[model samples]
Each structure stands twice: as structure tokens, then as C-alpha cells.
Target: MKLFFSYLKSHCKTLFFAGTSVVIFCGIFALDNLPLSAVGYAALLSVCVGLVLIAADFLHFRKTHFQLLRLAKKVRYGLDGLPPAQNRIEADYQTVLQELYRGMTELVTDCDCSQRETEDYYTLWAHQIKTPISAMHILLQSDENENRSDLQDCLFQIEEYVEMVLSYVRLNSDNTDLVVKQYPLDSIIRQAIHKYAPLFIRRKIALHYQPVSFTVLTDEKWLLFVIEQILSNALKYTRSGGSVEIRLESGNTLIIADTGIGIAPEDLPRIGQKGFTGYNGRQDKKSTGLGLYLCRRILSKLSHTLRIESEVGKGTTVKIGLESTRLRVE
Candidate 1:
């Protein structure tokens, strides 16, 4: 209806002129004393022809309008260009649109290149920094002193930070190195527990983890990163005497619960969000608000899910669903 009204509006001047001509011709005929019935028939025929032409034009106009709308929505994907030009004015509009499309494609290409270069530079920098970190680790290990252990802990934290940096960069890269295969689940968990063994010992935190006799299909490296990150957070918040437990439940989920100061109720929902540090993080002043965020991202890519349950001053329990789309429990 709207299109019909708009079409009529566009040709209103032509319609008006035709109607006026018909009226004037009838008056002239009556003044000359010609047959009134013949004049009436001729006028009726002209009006019917005019209506048919308008209907055809409206239908064509509607089809073209819808086609342009679909093409506009898909222009960014380069799926198709604008519909073929109709008149010279339409051709000029299409010519301008084509030039704009070319310019847009060039801009997108340039931006992609610039972004890749920046990611490569930072990724390289993250890798290069590991060398000095390794050197420092060796030097620190060679000495025996009261502060050696503490210094080593600091170095360990630095290494974790660097790993986070590398992970962050790679996570956003256009290409990711994810090797999915079936492997012993305990193997990945063991690696994370082994790395944090020193922290557990130093903090006097009890670790209760039994070997999980299961094999899961996932990217081992990325999954390991998520496990380590969760464990790191567990240790960071748990007091010296608190305990951390790792267990597999219902055969398709892994739960890591910590008897640490739990998340504030207000902050629980926002735990994995980027740069979101809740009440506890604000107190410790050491939280980067990236660990959980990275873990969630990695898990999602692995066809896994993460859910957290916590209570302030009690503890936080992180449950990771290991069921992939390929696996059916029933």
C-alpha cells in the first residue's frame, strides 16, 4: 500500500495533466455540439490505459526496491553487487556505489594487514621475553638463600604473566593452533598440578586430586591453559590453610572448588568478563581480570562450558562441562 501511494505521488503531476486535458477536451466537444456519448467513451478508454501503465510501473518499482534492499544488507560480504542499472540516472547511482565498494574493499584489506603486523610484533615480543625469564630462573635456582624461594615465586608469577600475554595475543590472532585429539584427561590436569605444586606447598594448601580415568577429545594445549589459569586463581585466593579439590563428576564434567575467600554475590556473574575485577580483586590489588576470561574463551572453542558458583568469604566452585557435540552420554 505504501509503495502504491509513493508511486502515485511520484507521477501525480502526469496524472493531474491527463485529467485536466480530458476535462478540457470534453468541454470543447460540448461547445462544438459533437456526440457527447462518443467523447465520454474516448475519455474512458484513455483513463483505463493510463491505469494499466501505472500498475505495471508500480510492480516493477516494487521488485527493484526489494532487490536493492537485499543487496545493501550483503554489500559488506561482497556476495553480490547492486542490481543492473535501469535508466541513465540509475546507472550513475550504481557507478558511484561501485566506486564506493572498491574503496571499502581496499580499506578493509589495509586494516587487516595492519592488524596482523601488530599482532605479530607483540607475539614476537612475548616470545622473546621468555628467554630472559628462563635465564633469571636458572640464576635464581643456582643460589641457596632465605630469599631464593620468594624470588623464585616472583619469577614464577612473571612466567605466568608472560604466558597470559602470549595466550591473549594468540587468542585474538586470525589463525589459532588448536590440535584436537583424544588423550588421557589426567595427563593435562597433571601438568597444571605439577606446575603449581610449589605454590601449593609454599601456601600449605591441601590438594585433593585423584587420577581421572578418562580420555577427552580436545585441544590439549588450550585446555591445559584453562586448567592452569583456574588453578592459579584458586591458589591466589585460598588462604594458607585452605584446600582445593579437583574431581570429575557424572563422567562428563570437571569441578575445581576452592575453600578460599569466595566471590562477592554481586561479582559472581561478572567473573569471566574481560577486565572485570570484583570485590576480592579490588582488595588483593593483584588480579588482572584476565585469567578467567581467557579460560572461558578457550573452553568455548573446545566445545566445553564453564559455570561458577560462589559465596562471599566461603569459596568459589568452577565447573567445566567436558561434553562435546560429538559425544553422547546416553
Candidate 2:
């Protein structure tokens, strides 16, 4: 109804002119003492015809309006839904839309190609760089050099960063490697602990681990990466003589709590965000602000949740919630 009124308003000038002409014709007939009944019939007929025409035009307008709405919904998929042009103006608008659609399609294709090329380059670089790192590890360990332990630790950190580069690349790629199944929970946690044994010893941080004998449905490799990242942070912020403990709570929540330089209360909210490093990161120049971010992302992909609670001077507790994850019983 509102649209019909607006449409009538648009042709108000024409309607006014026609009404004025009818009034003038009637006045002239009256002044000449001519019959007014015929003039009244003709004016009534014209009004009825005008009403019918306006109703038909309103129906067409409504149909086109609905068509444009549906077209807007499908615009993301394609631009083939332009309604049949009803006038020269509508036809010109459709032509402009087609041109815009063509340019947008081309732009999307180019961006996809460029993104693939960049990912490929980085993947290649990560693989090629691993070879030299391995060689360096071999050289540093051979014959038991005086600084072998320290050198190996540094090399290990370098390897970790390179692995992070690969992980970051994989996260953004279309193809990701994840094989989910029942994995011994203890074994996965132990593996992560073992990998950082040297770091633990070097930092002189005590590890208190309680084995929770069970199986969790998850991707072992990805879960291990998440655990390792947590362990790395736990060890990084903990000072000598401090302790880190891994235990199970509430049957399905795995907790890694560290007696380290805990996170500030204000920084806890944004701690896991990508490229976000709070106070500790600023103090530790080597922090890349990606470990927790990667851990969060990987755990989420495994249908698990990551939660952290920390106090500035006390400690931080990292929890992996596995109760709600998708797992089928054997």
C-alpha cells in the first residue's frame, strides 16, 4: 500500500493535469447550457480506468521488488539473476552490474592464485631450511663439544621456530594433515614432556606429572603440538627451582599449571589471540606471540577447548577441555 501511494505520487503532476482538463471541459459545457450528464459519465469512466492502470503497475513494481531481493541473496554465488529488463533504465543498470561482476570475478581468481603461490614458496623454504638445521645439529653433537648442550638447545629453539613457520602456513592452507583416532592420553603428554626434557633440566624446573590412564579421541600429532606449546610457555616463564605440573581434573580436563612469572590479570583476556603478546612477551624478547595462538587453533580443530587462568605473581593454569569433543567409544 505504501509503495502504491509512492508510485501515484510520482505521477501526481500528470494526474493533476488530466483532472484540470476534465474540470475545464465540464465548466465550458455548463456555461453553454449544455447537458452535464454525458460529461459526468466520461469523467467517471476516466477515473475508473486510471485506477485499474495504477493497480496493474503497482503489481508489476512489487514483482520486480521481490526479484531484486532474491537477486541480492544470490549475488555472492553468481550474477546471473538480473531480472528481465522492464525499461531502458533497468537495462542500463543490469549492464553496469554485469561489468562489475566480471571485474570482481577476475579479482578473486587473481587473489587465490597469488595466495597459493605465496604458500607454496613458504612450504618449499621451510622444507629446504630443515636440511641445513639437521646438518648443524649433527655437527654440534658430534665428538661432544664443550658447548654442545647449550648449542643444541639454541638449535632446538631454531627448529621450533621453523616448525612454527610450517604450522602457520598449514593453518592457512586448504589442505591440512589431521588423523583423528583413539590415542593413549598419557603417551601423548609424555611425548611432549620428553621433547622438552632438556629445557626443563636446563631451566632447573621440577616437573610433577600424574599419569591419567585413558584414551582420548584426537589427532595425536596436533594434540602433541598443543601440549608442547603449553609446556614451552610454562618453562619459559618459570624461573629456576620453580615447578610445572601436568594433571587431570574433572575426569576430562587436562591441566598444565606452572609456578612461573604468571600473566597479569589485565592481559589474560587477549593472551591467546594471534600475534598478541602482553607483559611477559614484552619482557621476553624471544616471544613470538604465536605459541598460545597456535595451541588454541589446533585444539579447536580437534574439537577441544583451551582455557587459561592466571594471577600476576602466583601462577598460570592452562586447561584443555576434552569432555565435549567428538569421540566414539570402541
Error of 2 at 136 (Å): 1.7
- Candidate whose lDDT is highest: 1
Q: What's the CA error at residue 18 for candidate 1, in Å?
A: 4.7
Q: Each candidate: how many clashes?
A: 0, 0
- How many angstroms is residue 301 displaced in model 1 relative to the true structure, after the best TM-score fit? 2.1
Q: Model 1: per-residue lDDT, tens digit, 204-224?
A: 999999999999988889999
TM-score of each: 0.87, 0.87
Worst 10 residues of 2 by lDDT: 321-330
Instruction: After superposing candidate 1 on the true structure, give the runs of residues whose Cα lies further than 4 Å from its correct spot.
Output: 1-34, 69-74, 77-80, 326-330
Per-model C-alpha lDDT, please?
0.89, 0.87
lDDT score at residue 265, model 2, on the 0-100 scale? 88
Model 2: per-residue Cα lDDT over 1-330, one tens digit each:
787787778788988998898889888888898767877888799889988887888888788878889989889788777778988998999899889999999999999899899999999999999999989987886747788888888899888898888888888787767787888899999999999998999889999998888888888888888898899889888889999999998988999999998999899999889889999999888787998999888887788999999988778999999753464433
